[model samples]
Target chain A: MPKETVSLRQAACTFVMFLFGSSVIMGVNSEAGQDSWISLLLAMLMALPIILIYARIMRLYPEMDLFEIVEKVIGKIGGKIVTILMIWYALHLCALVIRDFSEFIKVTVLTETPQLNIMLILILVVVYMSKSGIETMGKWSVIILPVITLVVIFTMILGLERIDPTNLLPIMGHSLGTIAGGAYKIFAFPFAETVVFLCLAGSLRKKDSPYKLFTVATLIATVIFLLVIMRNLLLLGPAVTNAKYYPSYTAVRIINVGDFLVRIEGSTALNFILAGVIKTTVCLVAASKGITRLFGLCNYKHIVFPLGLLAVALGTLLYENIKEAFDFLEIYQIYAIPFQIIIPVFIWILAEIKVRQDKAANGSHSPDSAQTDAAG
Target chain B: MNKKGKCFIIVLLMLFLLCGCQGYRGLDEMVIVTGIAIDKTPENDNYRLTFEIVDLTVPVKEMGLKGQVIESEGKTLFDAVRNAKKRITKKLYFGQAQIIIVSQEIARNEDVGIIIDWFLRDVECRETMCFIISQEETAREMFEIEALTHPLVSTEINNILELDQEVTSTTLCVELYKAFGGLHSEGEELALPVIHKAINNGKTVGETNGMAVFKDNKLVGFLPPNESKYYLFAIDEVKGGILTLSAFGEEHNISLEIFENKTGASFDYKDGKVKVTVKTDTTVYLGEVMRPYAPMDEKEINELEDIAKSELKKNISNSIKKVQSEFGADIYGFGNMIYKKDIKLWKQLAENWEEHFRTLEVEVESEIEIANTASLK
Candidate 1:
């Protein structure tokens, strides 16, 4: 298999773009108040230790990719079980992301276009991205990264005119418990999506270490998340911001530059679609690789098309409608923790334990060949 | 390697080709409705939906200043809208539409909640438009009447609603989206601006001063144009308006052009008692005094200030009581205020909001500044 190399800059850009797609504003703002930005900050901090588990796994298996480490650590039956769980998790996440993107498109761009049609169009892009491999998807991260930055900057700038500073007052107006609660749902999205990147950690230019790379990505996503929540809060104030759907988008719409640049509300929606596509591309590529490694396939591209179709079907049936989808997130988020954090940590633990035991039992295991062992 | 990649590329190319011929029809194809009026048919059983659709390409200047409205009658508002399809070639698009006016006759009779839910759910319907109740005339007539100026009459109507913020505290600038919030909210009743025709010569006029009051979503009665002004101010909608007062020897008509005004209510809950304080801060431009406060005496100005405060306070209390008793609707959003200020009070008063609001003592305090005297001073 050809090893791919993605730059640190590509990883940051892709993370920023992916956060834009994962309903960052929709997840935190609708329930959390104008202080949703605070929730996001807290959630990112909360998810840090969990993020470090993956970092530790990458540290332990510096030379091995996610699939390689799983096999080396869990030993066949256990490894395959973990690999299958991860594959299912990625597939489900890819489905959710696809659902969010298609639902957005259905509500914003193509109201008459059936949900299935939107999912189909989105799935086509995801499949093409997956088939093209990490090298090409990383190229997308590089391409979409700048566009996303411009969008965030422009939206924040335009949205500034409506900023009533009073909305920011009485900091931590949300009950401590409520704020604490929203943080986890908010954290699972952009923060947890970082877990999938472990599959491509080895593909990053060797010996550079993923520590700086993952940290940079998290920071970039955090900043965008912060700006979106702040802009929405300041524009609509506390209560109205919570009542609205796509608050960030409407906040942008409120950006009337002398009435000429009016109603570009859907621009954020466009940015989300573009960002979501890239994120799905990365995840799709990772999921395909996970499957290929588990099946011992020489190439992963063959799985991309079939999995892409499955993603479309899954998105189409994820929930009955947009409101229900977010409602499900409020409760069903409890179910996502194991996939995003637990499974990865489990792999990391088993990998580290086996590595330590193997090294202790056979101090010169690699250097001592069978001939040397028998001769001794 | 090249052959395999090329085959992949060729397949993608074929797919792109398959999707290439699809084209976007311009948003213009959909009728851009600016205002919608739901009125009961004269026969009273059917529905009359009047659409104030502005065709951008056709200049209003050419139409002698009147915008076009397509009227359709059916059993339901949706039916009326769909029936209009037969008359116009363009598809009806509600995205840019800003005003939804419900005729009082129908508003009093029908479930505005059900009618509004359709607009709320529709993707294209604009959320920030003014929601109104037709005072006396059919809303269809209001849609047909030409405004004094402005190509799009509804835009002018919306401007009036926006500008009313200075003179009045309660400009029911609440849109469909806000209306939905007020409905789903714990203890709030809905309110919509009331519109009526003020006739001059022998002609039918649709633009006039008056607002309909509703208990929940049903129209209960109408507020006089003056109360509408005070209510707008009470609700912080006062953009600017004139204040007229009379004394024994002097007639004081102060054109109080308000620049900035803030209306906020504080709900304080205690043992066996719940009270709401309605406070307003207004900056006003004083106008020409009929009897000479000659050099515009500070005493006279102070007197005028006191008068303005008392009048505003009286108006607010009266307005509150009328709404509470007549319609039992909390249009002023005391529920929302309490929800923000005291969530526990909101929970207690969430049910029977109107009754609780009526029973709850309302104390009104206002600070008015005579920012400037007309240049005549």
Candidate 2:
């Protein structure tokens, strides 16, 4: 079969959507109070180095996903153990995002609707997206990303009358330690969460540079997050923003432009759902890919449906209620470290050493043969 | 089955799941609530809720839109709301609710936080709905008055509160979100407009005027309409209002329409006491001159401007002092200003802010400009 490749632009769009996934609705950690924009900026700076490392791994193994790379670099036993860990992370992350979306809907709009229904419907759509292949998912992201950006910008413009810049006063009110903690939470969440993209990188066209894709997506997502943070802070003030479970929805609730454009928070709901669908789809695809590699299956698509069902079931049984789900986020940053930072770093370092060794071995025989050997 | 046929069957099944039949409620099945009035029962501590649901039975073109009131009693506000269904046939939808009126008794005796908690927590209730304290004996009485201009007294009160801010500046429109913020914030307190019944053209109507000041979440005192204007000026909430000035040794009164105004408060903390300097820049047009106007020279205009400035300064200082001694509530948000200006200083002062606010010294400086003579000169 011919290889399936995603264009560089499509991959960047998908990565941006993944970053915006749950953060758009859940909002960033507001522990920094009105200085949350500062925390977000700090988070982007901290995420930059890690994002570069992820891209470097993709560059080293140009045609292989992280699962294939891990098996190739580590021995068979070590690779299987690592793959099981990664598969668990991907499935848990998928369930978590699914739960966040369903909880938001249940709390805000569809109070009477059962969460199981919401999760099942969402998982079905995600499973279909995953079954159609990464190329379809990438194209869908390319089309849906602009709509999400426009909706966010539109709400920001309409809410301009309500913006009180003084709410952001005493800019450095938080101690550096508190702001750094908030930045760490933000980095683990939506920024470093892009580590999932390593599993999808195999589909990226060989001619396109992973470095450019990762950097561009991160910069764009950072700018959008900064605007969202400033918008919520300026409109709601830090006290109310921190008091609410969903600050973005609460902030957008007050956007009344001459009373004509009242209750435009529905648009915010749309933005979250669209971006969330892309994120869950990415996670589902990654988990299925890991499962296929672990079991030595011929195709990942064959088990996509069952994995999607398992994710929905896990989402439903993840927590007793919405409050517990939110409480989980406080420790989510620490929980994500091993997967987002530790394992990725280990793989990148091993890939680099292996590439150097391969180059040394092939240089003695023929310079042109190094590329073919690495591909093999 | 072929692959295409199986794919089609799955897509059809998914589409069936996408329909929101389970949670869907038709418009006719729900009664839209335009206003809510909460009162405390005279005999018990239970809440008495009066919801003014929109009367959709009458045709709009002939009778105009109207509201029908339904009363329910329960232990909590949400309970009272659900109990309202006993009298009505459908669920109360608050998505279109424009005003919430609470009785003075509830505002004075009960914790306003407990009363507003239900609205804040409910999904259907919009945070933008205006909140008001009724000056009448019972908040429901405010709804009993006939709606002369509009079919619904709640909508009429909403319109008055919204429009009066621009024309009178005697009341501040506090939305649910702003009230929630004020209740939770350490440095600032909540203040809402006061609504009452008045006879207009031999017909009773609901009118919104004056302001109710709160110390924390409990009502402390009230500011009359005239004093409320200066309160608006002190807080920089004045968009437009008439500032009447007496000229020629108090013989003739000249009403100056405020064109634009800006107020800024700066704090100076020293010797365990804080001093606030409030500076206001105002531009006005000579709206109505009691005496016939002769085209005045620049010196005359400057003199008049100084008179307007000193008059405004005296009124604003007096209003701030009245609130300080009478209510001790920082409705002007001076404490909030300090909190925003310097967090460390605020941390020191936030614990006993009320006592500090009562003893704090305030100085008012104002600059007024007569921008236009209103075509009289």
DockQ per candidate, 2 decimals: 0.22, 0.66
Candidate closest to the true structure, highest lDDT: 2
Judged by whole-model lDDT over C-alpha atoms, candidate 2 comes out at 0.88
Model 2 C-alpha lDDT per residue in residues A147-246, reported as the tens digit of each score: 9888778888989999899989888988999999888889999899888888877898776888899999999998889878888888988878887888
Which of the CAPRI classes, incorrect, acceptable, medium or high, describes model 2?
A: medium
Model 1 per-residue lDDT tens digits across residues A1-376: 7777777677667666766666654575746685677788898898777777787777776646788888888778877887887787778888888888777767666766677777777788788877777777777888877787788889788767656665664466568788877787788766776787777677676445566766777787778778778877777666557756666666665576765777887778878878788778777777888899888998888988898888788877889998987787876577777878788878877866776676668776644222223322
Residue-wise lDDT of candidate 2 within B151-238, one digit each (tens)?
7888888888988878888998889888888887668888899988889989788877699999868998899999999999988999
Per residue, candidate 1 scores C-alpha lDDT tens digits across B317-336 of 88777776766677677766
Interface RMSD of 2: 1.3
Q: TM-score of the B chain in model 1?
A: 0.84
Model number with the top DockQ: 2
Q: Highest TM-score among the candidates is held by which one? A: 2
